[model samples]
Target: MTPYAKIRVVDASTGRGIPLVELRTVNGIRHVTDSRGLVAFHEPGLMDREVFFHLKSPGYEREADGFGYRGVALTPRAGQEARVEMTRVNLAERLCRLTGQGIYRDTLLLGEAAPIPNPVLNGGVMGQDTAQAEIYRGKMMWFWGDTDRTSFPLGNFHTTGAIATLPKGGADQGIEFRYFTKPDGFVRAMIESKESLPIWVSGMAVLGKGSNESLYAYYAQVRSLSEIASSGYLKWNDAAERFDIAQTFAKDRGWRFLDGHTVQHEGYILGNDPPNVRVRADAESLLKAEAYEAYTCLDEKGEVRRIDGKPDYRWQKSLPPISSTIEARLVREGKLRAEETHFLPLDTEGKAVEIHNGSVHWNASRKRWIGIFGRKGGKDSALGEIVYAEADAPTGPFLYAVKVCDHPKYTFYNPVHHAFLDKGSTIYFEGTYTAEFSGNEDKTPLYNYNQLLYKLDLNDPRLAHAKT
Candidate 1:
């Protein structure tokens, strides 16, 4: 008797049809499911023998089974299709590390495995932290906090500010070092002249619409290490070859700025009057002592209005307002205790888990807000465990988080999501990987004090049903 089979592939959790799933039979016949996840095939002289099927997809886990097993056997009736439910792969497995010239470069200009015995000049923008990546003008642009490696061997010696651009394709295509603050002749001159100004430019936020966009970089203005650290804001002047100081905090105010850390300028802008910007602020002594507070800003008249209705040119004068809505939801969902003063998600032990320099962005494919943050685990665990969380809205009731990547005995911080570089099912993010602050000096070769990329799939069931 002639044998024939019809198969329908679907997600195990959502039960939605998974398109383009490939299935191969033991007899060397291959069939790919269509948009509806249905595939049919026929073969003669196969009724007497047992048949097995192998399945494969990008976001779904692969499955293979031999004949005679009740669940694995393929015995489809004449007009009926056999349903094949494929489990979604975990987000961790889908993350692929990319290859590039690590954060530092030598005089020889070697690749990832270059030696650091005798470093003549600060090569390839030096080691950096808090990498902020964006896809601009058809290329990937990366801006990071350039550490002063000459000052100390430990991490984040001092931020000098760095920028690099990568060509199309992926990491294999290589990147071009565009700018470094310390190496730039003008910035070096300022530092050498003993000027009491900001030497490092970091915490960059790209603002404005297409063609009219501007890059706003943040700096801490200090004559000496002991002086009150103030938010020294700078705007990149393309016509001129330097970043000009846009705003500086008054010394008498005694305010320190913390979280202009990461900015989401796409839809958070409110009104047409120069557009109000939303900033995240962490409580220090300068502010009202509330942790992880959010503030609204208006950039039109060169003044930022705090939630208290006080306007000031300097960003520090504007105090971060409490986001009661998000705090209430988190408490209701048990993600935060009612007594906790911070807005970050709490661990099982009720400790306020710091996000450090995590990023939040919208996942268009999944129609949800996704975030990746550095989870501050206890001393015994890896300090660089990257956790993934999702929410219905940007300012969220982000209730649950799952650990996606665990680098035991190492330190990974400042996780940034590259939402513009996403390709439908697959999304990318990165962080500064090092052992400098982990208390254990053991470091991974070719990855110490450098940026590491992580790729996640939107179809992962763990992220899809994260709240559960």
Candidate 2:
């Protein structure tokens, strides 16, 4: 049915397909691998001729030949098969893109087998940002930040969402999403707004159980890049198929409110990294700011209590916990010592690691609460690096961390570990990958601003530092 040839890219060590591997001909014709690490290449006049392709992928490399070229010369034939092996140098195995078009585009074009019902495009969504998921109404619902479309660059910024049947197999297998679409087939804004500014949502979760349950989240209206104009709580309106504002918070009242991906621990909803901020998992309590508590080190009047230059930690209401960023600042200011901090995570090299955004979950296999987050300032690729750390308790002295994934020149930020996808020692996490903060101009087609899911094994020898 087609003149395309199948070129499969796989990890040399595991022999599994390597997604996002790029191959380009001398003429600059580019082909990128799909979720299965397969590329369907069909170039006019290049078929059946010997063509040399330069291979490039993040954290992957091929041995150079005597000519010092890290490429291969292969004779392309219609419907024929080829294979290229790349060695993975990163700790976490980069899997596939979860948002945007062309997820399985190449695979579907060649009439070959591919995952997902809609392979080329779904719900007219070309690109989307950091997605948050929740188990609601018998299915998993996804809410993302801003989205881009095929029609134009200035797309929906009012928040978009989708629902999908949770996949049964491991995360190594591909996953699919069916968006909540409008009449025009574009993904409709999940959170409606009268204002012209954009809105983003997080901390989405279901409160109560069974027939009395209701879904809720925290929404922020953005005027510029990330400056929040106003923030409030939202409740799902099943009749309208979108979120409705539950209550609005005054200035500075948003901090103690629920934020980030939350987890239910002992009948309470835990929010943010280290699981410090929490509230009772009930409708009435979650809506009340006085009901929320944070594992903080401040006095009742909101003043820091220091004993011998170290903070005194306790669970307090109406006050959010001190962050690693604050710890770093306090350490630099002689108010706190690096050796005695409770919240700051240190790398295996014994240096303080700044966490930009991440998720913390209780891992059953590791039996330790693990934090997987994006390293804020890294020499490797700015926000592209991911690090993993563990604590005996959710409130960490998550002291030692290991660099789990690395992107030399690309930015992959806001990593979240999917507790629902845990398969013993094998864990899955995803983040928004983009060129926005990396200072890189060349963005990978169909991948920029989409979530890239990664798999990390706790049993891997490289993760030994995080064991204890």
Candidate 3:
């Protein structure tokens, strides 16, 4: 009878399968595990012979036996499966590879080893609000706030709104700046009496609609110093193959603002139906220190219903009147509370950790809601750490934020998760890496005022055992 064995490789700590692990037998035959971390071998002639298996993978350390040899010697049993566990080299390793210089277009223009260093889009500006979507087939579009160079070294610059595209499906490839709203562009074309110019499209949600599957983008506009302005939509024109503000939509009922008060509509959109698409807006009272969020529904008639059921439209020239608001009804039914929508998470010290800009996504594999947010303050002060928290629900009492990445003297803000770009147990996220808000007067060359990408493995023991 031939000796046969089925081998499986998995992370020792988390018990999750580790794919692409290499295994070699004493007979010099080699094999690699599949996506499920499984591989099988059978040898007829060596039925009674003892076999030894060697395991190896990049960025991982192998466990040793009493003799310090790096393999496991085992006697095969017919029709049985054996499991081998491997440990990661460093689960909390904060390492990232800088691929290109400036945006994708700049990288191509200034080939490797160009005499002069490439300048980032609109001078030395950080890429904030890293919103990503696959509008077209296999093409990834990234929208961000182009904080054009500021005259004051320590002050933040206003955004002109820029976009870049990666056609190779991965962000690792070179990027090309597709659309960059100039200082004299439409976003900056209008001037408010007491407000600043260049309203920024800070938070955006790319949605699809209709039979032809046309795409539309809903964004939260903000004035200078991050003041909430209004909410509007943009339509994708197939002829131009670009997005344009739906002027008609904006003209009719797209604007939502308040006088002497801030009511910002920021955060992701959920649900599918056009009439019932849920908008999670982070409402901050700049006058006071109070900050909370609310869930509003966008009806087919372009009416926004507040959580309390009131039509929260500011202008209604020819629009229908809001018959009744849901506020009273929801309160009477005990379905809504004014105190439950606070958006910040608490740290280990029981202190509230303010979240400036981050992403929240449902991780079905982990069966938990994962949120990646930039910490407002820590050992390195504001924007020094990227925190990770999990919860049972999207709107959560997200507690015990774990410090995943520590940027001591650097500022990393607007950490966005690209769930659409996730690869198995490993997920990718990017944030604006700059020294603008770090209190560091000096800027690091080639890395300053650009975006940095990070890879987090969900199977890591630290992340797997993350507290809810």
The worst-scoring run of ten residues by lDDT in candidate 3 lies at: 255-264
Candidate 3 ranges with C-alpha deviation above 4 Å: 1-138, 147-196, 209-211, 218-223, 226-231, 247-344, 348-351
lDDT of each: 0.49, 0.83, 0.48
Residue 221 displacement in candidate 1 (angstroms): 3.9
Give the per-residue lDDT of model 2 (tens digit) for 408-450.
7999887888878778998999999899988899899888888
Give lDDT for model 3: 0.48
What TM-score goes with each of the models? 0.55, 0.94, 0.50
Index of the highest-TM-score prediction: 2
What would the per-residue lDDT of candidate 3 be over residues 1-468, giving only the tens digit for each residue? 323466667767767555445677777676655324555556666444577878764334578888775776655565566778787653433222222234322222222221122323343343333434444433455444434333433322233333445435354332344443445432221112233433343334333333445444444455646554554545456655545665212332422221110111234343211111233332222111112112343344543446466434332223322211232234345543422322445565555555555666767677766777777666764685777777765545464566676566678776766776666666667776678778888555445565666667787667533464
Runs of candidate 1 with Cα error greater than 4 angstroms are 1-90, 93-126, 134-140, 148-168, 171-176, 180-203, 222-228, 252-261, 265-354, 378-382, 464-468
Model 2: lowest-lDDT 10 consecutive positions: 165-174
Highest lDDT, which number? 2
Q: How far is candidate 1 from the true structure (C-alpha RMSD, Å)?
A: 14.9
Which RMSD values do the candidates have, in order?
14.9, 2.2, 15.9
| Residue pairs that clash (backbone atoms under 3 angstroms), model 1 | none
User: How much is the lDDT of residue 315 in candidate 1?
Assistant: 25
